[model samples]
Target: MTLASLDRISPRKGRLSHTTVFWMVFAVIMALLVIAPFVLPVFWLKFLTEILIWGLLAMSSDLLLGYTGLISFGHSVFFGLGMYGAAGALLHSHPANLWLAILCGLAGAGGAALFVAYFSTRLRDVYFAITTLIFAQIFYVIIFTWTSVTGGENGLIFSRPHFAIPFLVDFKFDRYTMHWFVLALVAGSYVLLRRITRSPFGMVLQSIRENEARTRAIGYPVDRYKIVAVMLSGLFAGLAGVLYAVQNEFAAPDFVFFITSGDTIIFNVMGGIGTLVGPIVGAGFFQLLRELLSRLFGDQFPYLIPVGMVFIVMIIFLPQGLMGWARRWLNQ
Candidate 1:
């Protein structure tokens, strides 16, 4: 589709604004989150936290690809950098707040993005993906090579964000608390991103995605816009990375692995890339399938379940993701 056509494609095409139904669904989600800790098993909460983190990562990818028409194959760099930065901050800092660790992770990822953007913006289409993949490999090498600093192959293990207070110097983070805190953060991010994608900038990227040449010819600084989009995506991917590290209490070179980027792409498509709520639903569904398959077949069933599920989803639905179905149902 053309940029103009996409822009004029009714941004509100699927926005159903019946206040009661909207509030009811939201209330139900919040209610589940609230009573979930008491009602469900402990480890389930941890799983949900993972869903949120990956959901954020998927959303970041959607911004680059679904909106800006830039398909990246190295998003793992942002995610891994965030994980390393957060872990490193907690381990090295004298005073650590979860908030500060998150900020540091974001800053670290942003800095890396700045460097990557210098060369990446020079490429377009598949070349962009190739360059991004190279960047991801560079980061993987950095973590693996700088064993002394990033703990090399072992990575870093810590209890929580490091904070040595004057009086209470020995506080620890409860798993459940961290889970809920990250959930709140994820929910907040979801709302913020929703608003962002509805704004003028979002439209610009959507425009660019549909037709970059036309957008550039119309006098927009296409490269500059793409760089900004990449930066924003990296920032959120960093946040997701920190959450992943803290929730697992582990950070490793695996965080930047190529598969991590591939998995994020899977979630983006599985959840419906352009749809706002798709990532969360997609992450939740995939995680559930993973747990179920692992329990049934040990480790062998692994990717089969997700890939098989994807096959089914694609065969029947074609262009639509899970959220797309929901939107169609709601609109009906």
Candidate 2:
């Protein structure tokens, strides 16, 4: 083969090698996670479950920010809605059916996503973000003041529903079972999002991200795409919230605030935006860092000061994020 031909082939080989290594790492990590609930202490198991929930939320944010180049500061709205929807179902229903609660959560989140997308998707850049933020605040106020239904600031607590399938599997959820269930759902979501990002629809979203004008000029319905993207992202975020509500046995207004959305953005920035796994890793890292700092400094010391410092450093030095750095290393 000609030297030029060999040079062209070498890059392909490198890409193949990188892909292989990525999947191998993914499989190993998943295996460890599967075993974690059984081996880890109860406290750590609960912590890990929280990380997975937050990671799922981060991944949902990534679907818009990383893939579609849409910055949504109101994902917490969808999340909170999901939590409340589940809480409402479980609290009001006689049997407290797990399926009913999950369906309610999904419906509430999906409906909210559609409503938000219809209006917010028309705006571009910072306007879109502000619109989302406003929507979130509006929901927050309603939930906080509506004491008759939502429990106001106290939120709503309910019993953990039994995990059941029709004439198939039925059981109560202890910490271990809950952890495994959350892990399964999160992992499934990761896989589904990964597939979506590689599909033709994902390509169009990326094109829109790169140049909205060009994508629109190419005959694609840019507004429609953006709207769909927002809805999809919101649905996933809502799912994360539902899982969190289930695990914690409560739903609170604090989670619906814009601050949660901001933290999700931070997770995307810390993890590497475009990569599916990055946000999850970012969530885990962020949580672990906060835990460590809080332990060292105590609650009164304001651990966020140190956490913010580290985030600033990462932004300055590792702007592409942890996954981006890891990719570069693997390519080398």
Candidate 3:
């Protein structure tokens, strides 16, 4: 618009753009990840694994909430489906291993999403959320009531992590190796989500989120995209559930419970929803805080008080969350 502003923005012919700096920062983060396993404690490492799992779940929710403008409270149903699917697979006539059971769980979540999204996608906002919530509770009740199959309240605790192969004790109870496994999955999910966010599909979802009517008028099949996104989200959430079941070698009826889903939503909001990376940060923050509080305060009255204060402070001061604050700080 003006000569002074133009001169400020224009490159002096050879400098790297701001995009280059962003990558540089990301590269440094990757380097830190490479060294994390050896540095982190065993307890914290396991906690991080749970955080990564839920972080991915929250990321999937953000895909619907942030990118597609579809907020369905029933995501917990898909999450539960995956959990039970994995557990049930192990109980089948021909029992499945952890990996196969995980796959089965993801399939179960995806299948449920397919069945629900078919009808729910036609609605919007509260209607869609309510439909999902009802279906999720239905699934929860089914899991709760189906005691013989689900092992009832006692739960099913299978033997230790037995590899299909003969003698690989390294991956069994060695916290170090187990942590590496989790780290690899977490890193892989992060890369996949980044690509999803940058892909054409991601852009289309964002467009739909911004204005579905205009996107549909411009010839995009908006409802179909939403359905696909929901299924995909379930796939990831189920994968997370499989990891949860395997890591614990136990499956509770509560896997598909509404409270479990609510926890994820809280984590998503706490971490800065829609940013993709925010959920991981938020999950880690909360888990770490919870652990520390349990140790320091011992589940007393003021236990939640500190955690609540932290969230309140974040909401008021850093509404966008840690990633937002970091971006601003780095830019400045």
Q: Which digits, one per residue and each the tens of the lDDT, describe model 2 over residues 1-332?
A: 23422432254556676578768988999999999988999999999999999999999989899889989988999899889889999998877888888889988898999999999999998999999999989989999999999999999999999898979998999998999999999999999998888788988998888899999999999999999999888889989989999999999999998999999999999998888788999999999999988888787788888889999999998888898877667546
User: Between which residue pairs do clashes occur in model 2?
Assistant: none
Candidate 1 local Cα displacement, residue 13, angstroms: 10
lDDT of each: 0.79, 0.89, 0.74
Give TM-scores for every candidate, taking all chains together and pairing residue i with residue i.
Answer: 0.88, 0.94, 0.86
The parts of candidate 2 lying over 4 Å away from their true place are 1-20
lDDT (Cα, tens digit) per residue for candidate 1, span 105-160: 99988888777877897789999999999999988998989988999999999877
Greater-TM-score candidate between 1 and 2: 2
Give the top-scoring candidate (lDDT): 2
- Give model 1's TM-score versus the native structure: 0.88
* lDDT ranking, best first: 2, 1, 3
